[model samples]
Target: MSKVLQFACHFFAVCVSSNTPTAVYLGIMKHNGVPVDADLMKSRQQEAEQQMQRIRNEIIMLIGDVEIGANCGTKAFEDYLYQTLKLPVMKVTASNKEAADDASMIMLKEWCDANRPELSSLFTLVQECRKWSKIKSTYIDGYLKYLNSATGRIHPDFFALSTETGRMNCKTPKAQNLPRKSNDPIRVRNFIKAPEDHLILSLDFSQIELRVGAFYCRDRTMMETYKNGGDIHAATTSVIFSCTYEEAQDKHRKEYKEQRTIVKNVNFGTFYGLFPKGLQSTLKFKAGVEKSVDECEAIIRNLKSGYSALTTWQEETKRDAAGKMYIETWLGRRRYLSNIRSENWGLKSFAERCALNTPIQVTAADILKLAIVRILEGLPSRPWLKPILQIHDELTFIIPKEKLNEAVIFIRECMEQQPFPEFDLPLVAEASAGESFGNLEELEG
Candidate 1:
C-alpha cells in the first residue's frame, strides 16, 4: 500500500491579484487544498478541471473517511435524506375539513414520533414536526398561497436560509426552525439515523464564546480567570465590580450579563460606528435601565481595552482590505466586505460588520475544521466512538453504553491537543458526553 501524500500545517497570508471574477475562486481553492495559481487555473479549462479533482481528493484525505461522500453537498444530502427518511409531504386543501389521501400534507409529526429512532437529529426534528402539524393549517395555506409553486419540495427549498450568502438554514420535515436551532424530539433530527453496528458520538465545548473572548482579549487579568477555572461572565463581573468571583454571582446575573453584552455591543460598534440610540435599545436594557451616553462611551472604552487584539485586527485587516471586498481569517478563510466601499449607508454598515465578524467567524470555522480532521485521525484502530454530525462548533458522536468515561476522556483529548505541535495557554475544552445533546448539557439533580 502506498502512503497518502498529504499536506497540512498552513499559515495564512494576504494574497493580492488583479481584480477578476474567476481568479478569486481559484485563489480560495488554492488556500483550501491545492496551490493552484489563479492565472494558471483561469488560463486553461483542462487545468481547472484537474485542479478541482485535486480539491476533491484533498478533502477526502483531510476528513479521513468516506461517509461524508454518501450525501456529498446540499442537494445530494437533501435527496439522500428525503428518500431514506421518506418524510410525508402534504399540502393543505384550503377546505374547512381535513382530507386524507396521497395529496394530504405528509403528517410530519406522525412520521417523526412513530418512525424515528433514538438519534439526536431525529429527536430534535420530531418535536418540531408535531408542533407544525398541530398549528392551524389555515395559516400555513395562507402563507403558501401567495408564493409561486416552482418551489417543488418543502425540505430542499425550505432548508435554504439565504441565497446571497452561502449559508443555508433548514426547518424540520415540518416548516419550523433551522435544524440546529430547533429543539424538537422528532422533526428535523429524525432524518438522521445511526448504523446498526455503530454508535453516534456527540461532543460540544462549554462556554466556547468565553474561551474565544479570553484568547482575543489578551488581558492577563481576563486570561488568568479562564486559566484558574473561574466562571468567565462572573469573572468579568468581578473585574468590573471590584468584587470576588463568588461575590459576583447573582441569580439573575444582570450585572454579568450587562458586561458580556457590552463587550459584544462594543465589539459590534467598533466596526459599525454604533449610534447612542441604537446602543440603548439592546436586550441588556430590557429592564428599562437605558444605557446613558456616558455608559455607552464607557462600554466602548472597556471593549477596546478588552479585545485589544481585535482593535489591532480591525486596523490591520482594513489596511489589508483597502478598497477590496474580502478579509482572510487566521486559517486563510476570506470573507468578502466589498460593501464597505459602497455608497449606500446600509451596505456600508454591513460591510463594516463583515470586517469585524469575518475574522472571528472564519477563525472559529477554521478551528472547527482542524479539530474534526485531527479527531478523525486520533481515533483508535477499533475505537467504539464514531462521528455523527458537525452542526456548527458542536460535534455529535455516538458512544457505547459502556465506554462512556473513556469516550469522554478521548473526545476531550482530541480537541485539547489538536492540529499538531502545542497550543499556548492550553486550549481548554470543556465537554460533557451523554445520551443526547440536550442530556449532555444537563446537570445531575
Candidate 2:
C-alpha cells in the first residue's frame, strides 16, 4: 500500500504509463490558469540572439588574431596564445570542419588543457552564449509555439518516477528544466504566472542535500555549523582559507568571497563525487580561479584531508554498491544498478558515483514525495489552495489572496515535519510569495 519498495518493479514496467501524482496535480492546477508573457519571451529571445552574436563576433576577432602564426608552446607564447587570445587547445590534425572553418575544428577540452589559465574567460563566454542560445531556441520559441493560443498554456508531460534518483522529468515543452535563478536574459519561468485573484507561493528546502550529507557523514564541523545556525559556506571558508570566522563573515572581502565560492563548489560537488579535472573546470569557469590539473589535484587532496570522513564514507558506499550491484534510499526506494559490476572503467566510475549520490538524492526525493502526498491529502480540506509546479527542491502553489497566510503555515509545517525516521535533524524550508511565478519575495516568519 505504501508503494515504497515498488520502484524496482515500476522502473521496468514500460507497458504501464498513465497519470502519476505529478500529472494528477498538473491536471488539477490546470495550465490555463498560468499567464504567459509572450511579448517578454519574444524580447528575451531577441536579446539572447544579440548576446550570442556579440560573443561570436568577439571570439571570431580573437580567432583571426590567433590565425596569424600563434606558436603552440613556450610560457610567454602560451600565455599570449591561451590566456590573452583565449584560444582553445587544438590538435593540428585533419577535421571535418577544416574545409568550412579551420577554427571550428579545434577541440574545446584539448585547447583548454593546453591553456587553462588564459582560456577561462573565453570558455565562460562561449558557454554562456551557447546556454542562452539553447534557452532562446527551446524555451522561448519552441515552448511558445507549443502554447495553446486560446489559453496561453503549455501542458508538458511529467514523468513521476522516470529518474533512478526519484526526480521528476518533463518533456514536450520541458517545464521542469525552465531557467529559474540564472542570469540568463530569456528565462521561461517568467511566463508562468498566477491568476488575477491568486498568488504563487514557493516553498523550497534550504540546503537540503548538504544537510543530508552532513547527517550521513557525521562531519563535526558541518554539524556544528547547522546546529549553531551559522552559514555553512562561511564556516567552510574559514576552515579552508585559515581565516577567522569573523573574517569569513565579511561577504564583501575578495578573499572571503572566493573562499566561500570554492567551499560551495566543494560542498555540492563532493557528494556528487567530483574528480580533480571536474574541480579544475568548476574553479576556472564558475569560481574564475584558473588552476592547472596539478593544482586542482592538490586542492582536492587538501579538501579530502579536511573532510576525510565524507570521502571515506562515499568510497565505502561505492564499494558496497559495487558488491551488491544495487543501492536503496534511506526510505527503502531501490535503484538496481546493473552496471555497478561493469568491467568498463567509465561505466564503473559512473555507477560508483551513482552509488555515492543516489542515497542522499533519492532520500531527498522521497521526503519531497511524502511532503507532496501530505499536502495533497490536506488540500482537499482547503479548496482555496492548488499545487502548481514542483522544481527540484521547491514546491509552488497558487492560492487565493484570503488564504495566503493559512497556506504558508500549512506548507511550512508539512515540509518541516520530517516524514522519515532516519532524519534526526530538523528540515528548514524557505517560503516566498508573489503575484507571479518569476517574481517572488521571501515571507519572513
Give one clash count per candidate, in the order shown: 27, 3
Instruction: State candidate 2's TM-score.
Output: 0.78
- Per-residue C-alpha lDDT of model 2 across residues 1-445, encoded as one tens digit per residue: 4565466556434213222454566566555344566777778878877877777676556544443211122244345554775564543325421121223222454456565645445545555555666777778887787777787666666567788787766677666676646555654676777778888889999898888888878777778788788888877666666777888899778776567777888778878888988898788766767668986677677667777778888888888887888986665556778888889988888888888888889777767766776676687799888776777988888788888889989998988897667677668889999886777899997
Question: What TM-score does candidate 1 get on C-alpha atoms?
Answer: 0.51
CA RMSD per model (angstroms) = 19.5, 7.0
In terms of TM-score, which candidate is strongest? 2
Model 1, 165-281: lDDT tens digits are 222222222222323334332223332333344334456555554455345445575567667876666655554445666766764665656565554544334443355556665
Which model scores highest in lDDT?
A: 2
